[model samples]
Target chain A: MRLARVIGTVVATRKEESLIGFKLLVIEEMDPREERPTNNRLVAVDTLGAGEGDVVLWVQGGAARVISEEHRKAPLDVAIVGIIDAVDIADE
Target chain B: MRLARVIGTVVATRKEESLIGFKLLVIEEMDPREERPTNNRLVAVDTLGAGEGDVVLWVQGGAARVISEEHRKAPLDVAIVGIIDAVDIADE
Candidate 1:
C-alpha cells in the first residue's frame, strides 16, 4: 500500500450498481517522508470512512472489490483501505 | 492500475495455504512513456501467465483476491491482472 491524501470527492449518479453506497474520493499520491504531493491522482473508493485531507492507505485493482462486504462484485479499480496513523522509515 | 516489469520470482516454502499454487514475482514500477524503472519494487501474484521481462498491468489491495476463482480468499495484497500488449499515450 502507498500513502495518499484525499483531495476531493467524486459524485457520480449513474455508476455500477454494486458501487451504490460507496464514497468515492479523489486522492493524490504523497512522498513517503516529506508528504509532498506527487503528480499521480486517482479516484478511490473510501472503505475506512476517510474524508478529504486525511492521509489514507489505498489498494488498487481487483483487490479493491473485496474491501467492503456489500460491494463484493463492484467494478472498482481503486479503494482506500485504511487511514494512516504514522509512518516511520528506517534510514538505509 | 499501473505498469510494471517482472524482474524476478519469489519462492517460499511455508506460506499462506491459499497461495500455494500461485506464482509470486518481483515487479519494478515503470514510467508510462519511457518504460524506465522507478524506485518501487513489489512481490505480486501472477494470474495471467506473465514471465520475467514482461510488462504487465498490476492491481493491488483486496481486489486482487477476486482475479482467480480458486484463490479468492487468499491473503494476497498485489496481483498482475494482465500482460500489457501496448500503451499509447495521446499527445496533449
Candidate 2:
C-alpha cells in the first residue's frame, strides 16, 4: 500500500450503482520517506472513513473491489483502506 | 486500474500461507497514454496468468483481497486483475 493524504471530497450524482454509499475523496500521493507529495492526485473510494488532511493507506486495482462484497462489481480502481497512526522508516 | 508490463517473477519460499499458489510478478508501471515505463517497479500477485512482456491491469489495497475468498486474509497489497488486449485513448 502507498501513503496518501485526503485533500478533498468528490461529489458524483450519477455513477455506478455499486458506488452509491461510498465516499470518494481526492488524495495526494506521498513519498514513502518524509511524507512529501509526489505524482498526480487521485480520487479514491474511502472505506475507512478518512477525512481531509488524514494520512491514509490506499490500494489500487482489482483489490479495490475487496473493500466490500457489495462493491465487488463497482468500476473502482483505487480505495483508501486504512488510516495511518505513524510511520517509522528504519535504515537498512 | 493502472497499466503495467510484467517484467519478471518473484520467488518467496517463505511467505503467508494464503499466497502459497499465487504467482508473484515484478511489474513496471506504465503511463496510461503511451504505455511508457514510469515511477517504480512493483511486485504484484498475478491472477489472470499474465506472462512476461504482457500488459495488465493491476489493483492495490484490501480490494486485492477480493481476488478470491481464500485470499481475503492474505497479506497482499497488489494484484494483477486482467490482461489487457488494447488501450484506446480518445482525445478530450
Q: Which stretches of candidate 2 lie above 4 Å from their native place?
A: A1-70, A73-75, A79-92
- Candidate 2 chain A: worst-modelled 10 consecutive residues by lDDT: A10-19
Collision count for each candidate, in order: 7, 11
Angstrom error at residue B17, model 2? 1.9
DockQ of 1: 0.08
Error of 1 at A29 (Å): 8.0
- lDDT score for residue A46 of model 1: 79
Error of 1 at B42 (Å): 0.4
- In Å, residue A3's CA in model 1 sits off its true spot by 16
Model number with the top lDDT: 2
What lDDT would candidate 2 get against the real structure? 0.72
Fnat values, candidates in order: 0.12, 0.10
State which docking tier applies to candidate 2.
incorrect
